[model samples]
Target: MTAKQDAQLTGVPSAAMTSLLPGPLVDDAWLAEHLDDPRLVVLDATALLPSPRHDGDHRSASGRPGWAERHLPGSRHADLTSDFSDPGAPCHFAVPTPEALSAALARLGVGEGSEVVAYDTGGGIWAARLWWMLRAISVPAAVLDGGLAAWQAAGRPLASGDTHPEPAVTPAVPVLRPRLWSGIEAVAAISRGEHPGVLVCALPPGGYDGSAPTRYSRRGHIPGSRSLPGRGLLDDTGRLLPRAELAARVGAVLGTADSPVVLYCGGGISAAGTALALTVLGRRDVSVYDGSLEEWSGDPARPLETGG
Candidate 1:
């Protein structure tokens, strides 16, 4: 693997956010009040990845149509799975170069001083994916807790039709934050126990246990990873669990270990949702495995483990 293979994610240098969010995660109540802020850019980064056999997210379905049917009043579609991905990469949803990402952000009207709030309908994973991508390059961004469902449940108004905001005047190029991204090398080292830190698998139970279908060529998870499905971090309404409860969920696995944590899942999507949860819990050392199982499992020599 080359340098690019190690850390696929990149972003602009940390620019001041005109409208600072309370934290990395925000609720519908807060967003409702800030809808009119010119510096605030809300993106429905909802990319649906269903099964390969069906017209699911990974294959044909797109969140654009759903965004068309109904979305936040001033929100635009930030196509994380496509527009922001490196189409030439071997795996799915590959993070593009800094130049590519800066261009994409410009297209989304995210210029310097912009505050991004990403939300998704399929769950917070897609939104979290966007958040992780931006934060990796020092962009000021956050995920909408519970996503579109929470927005609707709060009786917030929605609008149909597309939003084509004019390009940002001068979008700054992002600098990659290497620590936030773990390439295949880091994951393998951690898996082999040569590297310090825990390997956390954020996929569902079936995926972790090798009992469910996978998008990758192999089944099961990386060796020595603990099961913490991304969806498990969210409550029934799609909002993240309360802070104290969230601490308990993560603490159960982390304990007093205070070590670096590398998170991964199929194609690095859902793992981000878990990363968001950890960030909410104040763990800045968290990094998502960029390639995740899609890359790891591709090489049979890498090794895998199954069962609870």
Candidate 2:
């Protein structure tokens, strides 16, 4: 395979990697070099386990039990089912309140302007959630390319620590914003194609096709939505592809940064990952379908499109 093709397949890059996305994702070697850099904070956004299979298992869902098992040195857990998301919400893991998120950040030593890196066992799928959350809160962060598995494969050293990173002082609320999320009513009105919209199923082809279901009310996707699978942005190493390549892949499928994109997945976690990728690709007009298929698919009046 050609060098570029190999990079796409494995999601790993040699020393020199560049991206059109504003921020850059670090690999295991790079991360190891800066593990002690106070300016850089690392996080593990592994999926909350015991969840539906779609969430995957980067870490166990048994709370701190999973984190204690093993993680990047000095890294803290960003529980998708708890920390940055609202557990009481109907959308499964909807974005948490900015106030709650700020607190979570303080605990993670992620104050305003902190450069953060996140990773999960899978490719960027779970790690991207944290990346998106930081963006949503206006914190500058990126996912570690190739995740922990990649780090281990490279024969990198691992650290097991019982001590947690001290929290940072709460900073101002994050300024992260995405295209306005439409509710069920808005979705119903917009699906007629009058708005020139793009509804993206952030899950893999299987999830979008109803072949692999998550904790959603229904198995299908929003009517007329396209499958872009946030997971596609990652290479075999579980790291993000170079920015230029990612832009080409994501832009070609969704049009361009200027195109109106609405992203969603089982609940909204995975969709956030896709939205973050678009934002990194310089797409400013993207929004997350917060209610997503979870809210739209079961309604008799709403439409459901099924295909891989």
Among the numbered candidates, top TM-score falls to 1
lDDT at 167, model 2: 77
Candidate 1: where are CA atoms >4 Å away?
Answer: 1-19, 51-60
Give the true-structure RMSD of model 1: 5.2
What does candidate 2's lDDT look like per residue over 1-308, in tens digits?
A: 56533332223332343322225356677778877876677888876544566532223352344556887778887777678777778665677777788788778787754668888775566777667666555565667777888888888866776578567566656664443454666555557766666777888787788776556555677777778888787666655668888888886776643547777886666787776567556565666767776677656677676775
- Ten-residue stretch with the least lDDT total in model 1: 5-14
Clashes, model 2: 13
TM-score of each: 0.91, 0.79
How far off is residue 242 in model 2, in Å? 4.9
Per-residue alpha-carbon lDDT of model 1 for 128-246, expressed as tens digits? 99899888776778889888899999888999987565765576678678788899988888888899989999998988998777777778888889988888777898888888888
Instruction: Evaluate model 2: give its lDDT.
Output: 0.67
Output the TM-score of candidate 2. 0.79
